[model samples]
Target: MLFSLLQPALIMKISNIEDIPGHNIVEFYGIVQGSTIRAKHFGKDMLAGFKNIVGGELKGYTELLHESREEASKRMIQQATDLGANAVVNVRFSTSSVAQGAAEILAYGTAVKVVPHD
Candidate 1:
């Protein structure tokens, strides 16, 4: 999978619910998403195999997953911001194995504009 670093132009508030506690959704911009797949490098794969035998945490795999999630989230936030959304609601994440050694991570949500309710 190919991925480039993406920095969100704005900090978009994200939530797992349809609405923010103190704000009301003024407009819905539809869905936004970002996804990426990652496979371990040969060196890391070897290291992980050894660690698996030793029964300890596989730091290389851990880092790969962490970075993948960050990239996916960033891309999602960027999309939402570009659509004039101040927030993304009903945010969700999913992971799947696309291949024997590759894993795909996805982040998605509904982009919406919200205003504080009085």
Candidate 2:
């Protein structure tokens, strides 16, 4: 109820193309990007360290990264929509360690308006 009300109704479409397939780019609004950094809690960090030694996927770290990426992507789309873009093209993602126990995620793309090719 409250969660649904707070959620965005529209999520701008994104693609790894200069223009959407089968569509024409009618406008270009330059580049847009969103980034965030996250770190695991001390307990999760210790658990992850043990998992690393055991050579298994660190579930906590994986979920942290996944959530970070989703947040970044949502922010990027919001920025593009604020620029009056209906879509974001040539989307790209990047990740890097911002600190010993923290990682940064970035989502970037060119904001554009597109319509189906006639």
Candidate 3:
């Protein structure tokens, strides 16, 4: 109820971490988002980007990263919501190597309450 009211289900966008709240949002703990990418994928994207310089749309790779990030972010938010958080603030994102062929993407933010302006 609290979270559903604050973070409306309609505008369920998970993009920038800066758009979120802080760490002290609630007592509940949740991990809404999780992302994993492959280096070979990035490399392929880079190659595709290079080809775009002489051809057409270069949006493929960009879209790939964007979608992955969004998925991760959404998951994170969902996790927090599952824990009964109304909002998440002070979010931060980071990418790291998971293995020789893979990389991990993370989207994190604090879940908190946003009082309505009455």
Candidate 4:
């Protein structure tokens, strides 16, 4: 089910779990990771400040984080593919403030080759 959703955009399967259900991990290529740091522009930052006063969702910041996460995930997947991995297991994400207005998003997982059970 999840595989189908990911198939169009990526060849590598990514899962937070250790296993991929019907597939068996035949080989491991160690850890693969990717990260990106993002900061809102002056205009967006100003808007966010105003929104904070009203105590509402920061849509600008939300979109920025979403883009950062996607970029990081794509990079991680590319690294796994380069290592001859068909999937990434035990995937995880981390976020941290790199500066006052900048945040870093990281994606990491164990690269592995998997084969369907016979």
Top TM-score hit? 4
Model 3: lDDT equals 0.60
Q: Between candidates 2 and 4, name the one with more favorable TM-score.
A: 4
How are the candidates ranked when ordered by TM-score, highest leading? 4, 2, 1, 3
lDDT of 3 by residue, 1-118 (tens): 8776556444433324544332322243444555657454766667776886898765765566677777777677777667666666566788776776456778877555543333
Model 2 gets an lDDT of 0.86
TM-scores for candidates 1 onward, in order: 0.87, 0.89, 0.55, 0.91
Best by lDDT: 4
What Cα-based lDDT does every candidate model obtain?
A: 0.87, 0.86, 0.60, 0.90
Residue 71 Cα positional deviation in candidate 1, in Å, after optimal superposition:
0.7
Q: What TM-score does candidate 3 reach?
A: 0.55
Q: Cα RMSDs of all predictions?
A: 3.9, 2.2, 6.5, 4.2
lDDT of 1 by residue, 1-118 (tens): 1233333433578899988889999999999999999998899999988988879898998899989998888888888888889999999999999998899999999999999999
lDDT of 4: 0.90
Clashing pairs in 1: none
> For model 2, how does the per-residue alpha-carbon lDDT over 1-118 read when each residue is reduced to its tens digit?
8665334425466898777898888999999999999987899888987987889888888899999999998888888877988899999999999889999999999999888888
